[model samples]
Target: MDPLVLGGIVAISTILVLFSGVSVGLGLLIVSTGFLLVFDGLRSLELLPEILFGKLDNFALLSIPMFIIMGASIASTRAGADLYEALERWLTRVPGGLVISNLGACALFAAMSGSSPATCAAIGKMGIPEMRKRGYPDGVAAGSIAAGGTLGILIPPSVTMIVYGIATETSIGRLFLAGVFPGLLLVSLFMAWSLYSTWKYGDRALLASTTYTWKQKFEILPRVLPFLAIIVGVLYAMYGGIATPSETAAVGALLCLLIAMIIYKLWNPKDLWLVLRDSTKESVMILFIIAAAGVFSYMLSSLYITQSIAEWIATLDVNRWVLMGAVNVFLLIAGFFLPPVAVILMAAPILLPIITTAGFDPIWFAVILTINMEIGLISPPVGLNLYVINGIAPDISLKTILKGSLPFVACMVIAILLLCVFPGIATWLPDAVMGQAL
Candidate 1:
């Protein structure tokens, strides 16, 4: 059989299994095994262990589990709720204050968690009720949390960035640094949209000032500030060359556990067991997907399908901007149908070389890809964040939620344009930080 035919079979089978509701890891593994049998007979079996083990054995990958542990432990301890509450107290004075605070809390939590669903879950559990209580529309409240949650992968320490960095051989630390400005930019833009929504509704979301004295405001800081401090300290030390990314993650996890024990008092033996168990489960699921993706990626390379696709893309005579716009549209449409990990796994291999050959910045493209995935977090059918938020806000209608999310989606479109116009916003931090190290 032709290798391209074998490649197409493998890709189609994987998607079929996924569409049949099999776990992504199982789907990829089964599909890859089927392809290996048909395409190369039993010889492909010899290649499996090396590729799978090689993919899973990276030291940098250890950071994934540690970060998951940190996020779970923090959520389990309920420290994130305190952070949201404090932000609410401060921001509730603004028109559409609940929406603004939801976005703000999502940004802060995203900085710490770096997983979109986790961000939505963490903030949604707290922000939903608070927003609903403040007379905010249920759909608007749900939409804000869901949209804001996507900030997780756009921000630093993001799991998506780490995966992309590993796949592309880009510096993970530099990728983390590169995400900072764009993440904040998205947050600001989301907040602006929320304010605009309030204005359109004639400030219906405006909450009367319920006085919280300065002393009272100061008192709530003790509950949530330590988690914030851990993230800030870890990033600062990493930027200052005081620690490697993995080391910083380990230290941050340890510090977060300690804070949970001391401040939240929720890190007892049982709680610790649960946190570790949950972390292990989440880590295994993600690593399995990565391993399977690696195999799929390997098969693509072996079949020369990636090269063929890249060569085909190179034949297009379009300029860089047009190429980028085309890429963006493709990703956005695919994102509506695909989970983020799957999207990255499949598209990254096909798109990477094409963009590089066109003299485009891969780091900026990574950010652009992430922004497109951010849009997917709110899009229909398989939007993980939308489902997570829906589960949290059971009372909200899907139509209302989708309507409320439209403005933030528009904001993401604008944000993508800004990144396109000034690729340096994504590239500058990585270059400056890495250059200084040199």
Candidate 2:
């Protein structure tokens, strides 16, 4: 069979296997092995050990688990509640500020945890009930956090960005820098919509009391500022060249563990065990997927399918913008089914070359891809954040969650459009800080 035709079959078979409830890592492994067995014989199987070892030997990949540990340590504690409370105390003076606070908490926690579902769950647990008490409708209450939770992957220390950086051989530091402005831009857009929706729909009679004193507000800052400092420190360590990505992750994880233990009194053996267990599980899962993707990639390359696809893409005579649009649409669709990390590992190898060859910066395109992943977190079928919100507030149906998330999705779409017109939102920070990648 033609390599292109075989590649098409392999793609469909992988999707079917995944849709049939196989775990992503195992599914990819099975797909690659089965396809290679039939077409390339046992010789391809001989390369399996080398492929797995080569993929897992990456030292930069250590950051995934370290960051996961960092996020999990904070997540398994009261940090989320304290962060939400801290933001609420400060922002409550403004009208419709509770919703804004929830979104703000999401962004901050996202910076801290780098996991979308965790961000949604952490903030939504308290933030949702608090909003309902303020007479915000179910949709508004659930929508803000669900949409805001998507920020986790867009903010620095993001696992998705890390995966993309490693897979595409882009600078992890630059990728971290690339996300800063776009993440803030999305936060601002989400907040604006929050204020508008709350004022238009939330009950004035039940608005949160704004009568708290300066002393009360000041007291909460001590608990929240340290974690905020950690966020800044992680960004600084990565961008300032003080540490490599893995070293920064190691230090950041250590700080997060220390802070959670001190402020939250999470020093109990059971609590520590929970943090270890959760982070280990999540980290292993992500790492396994990476290894499987490596095998899958090897099969494609060895079979010459990757070269065929690239040649086909090169032959296309369309304008770069048109090519970009098609890629974005495909990414948006891929994100609907796969998590951000999976999409990056599966597609970035193919997409990055096309993007750079067409005169677009891979760094800028990283932001665009992250935003699309943000949209997927709230989209139907496998919208992880939406389900997390639903879990926290069982009364709110998935339909309602989707309704609330739609505007934020629109906000994401607008951000992408803006990035298209002016790619600097993604590129400028990295270039200024790192002296531009050659």
Candidate 3:
């Protein structure tokens, strides 16, 4: 049997299982097990324990749970509202400022939490109502929050980036550095759209209805400043080589949890339990997927499929840019179904060799991949952020949320093109800060 044929069948089967509503981790395991039995016989099972256990016994992976804990603690509190309100108070005077503020808050909070759903839920709860009350179009208001939330995976300390680093053996800290500029670039593009939307409807007055005095704005800062400081501290620790990813994540999670407890009076056992429970659940899901993907990758390699595919791609006569365009298209399609972490774990190993072979930096490709997944968070049929925002604003139809998010999706696409033309947007900061990725 042709290895490529088997690879194609495996890919299709995995997608079908996911579409049938199987969870990514489990769906992957089922496909992997089925193939190992059919193709490699039962004796291939001996390889499982080593690959799965070895894949997860890393110190760096510890950061995933800590980051999840940090994000969960913040999400289970009022930091989301406080962050949104603080920015709203400051940006209220500008036209379309309310929506712009939400985008800014999402960017800032994403830096802290590193989970798209958490970012969407936390900010969308407050931002949606306020925007709707102020007569911002429902689609636009809901869309802005949903779109802003996708920044979570593209920002530092991101679970997705960590997964990518682990899967591809790239530098986690350098990948985090790589994400910084692209993250900011997306935020700027989103904000630019918000500003344009306001100007397009200038007569309608897209400004926030609420107003705050300088004293009021200053007062809100004290509550939000600590979280902001955590963001700065985590970035500093990682980029300055002051701490390992695990160290910053652990300390940052503890600090975030304590601060949320003290400031929000959320130290009660239930809230604490909720954060811990949620963190454990999400972290376990990710770690399990990592283990499962390791098996799936091994099967592909053992079958000579990955090597064959990479060889086939290398033999293509098309321009590398054309190859990238096709890769982006394929990734965008995959993102529509799978979570970013799952996508990274399953696909990064397969694609990284091909990307580097084409004379592209793996770090720059990570940013592009992250952005594609960002678009998936809002794309219809299965976009998670779309549902998160819909949960917050149940009155807004899914179609409306998708509608509003379209422009921001275009913003992400534009960011990708910019990166292609000038790869430095993703590579420069990492190179400067980390001395070029090896």
**Model 2 misplaced stretches (Cα beyond 4 Å):** 202-208
Candidate 1 is scored at a TM of: 0.95
Residue 395, candidate 1: C-alpha displacement in angstroms: 1.1
lDDT of 2: 0.89
Off by more than 4 A, model 1: 1-8, 207-209, 436-438
Q: Is candidate 1 or candidate 2 better by TM-score?
A: 2
Better of 1 and 2 by lDDT: 2
Total backbone collisions for each predicted model: 0, 0, 0
Clashing pairs in 3: none
TM-score of each: 0.95, 0.98, 0.98
lDDT of 3 by residue, 1-438 (tens): 887788899899888987888788788878888898888899988988898899998999999999999999999888999999999999888888898899999998898899899999999989998887887888889999999999999888788988898899889988898898999999999999998887776625344376788899899999999998998998888778799999999999999999988999986898799889989998999899999899889888877889989999999999999999999999999899788888888888789999999998998999999999999999977899999888888888998899999999999999999999999998998888778555
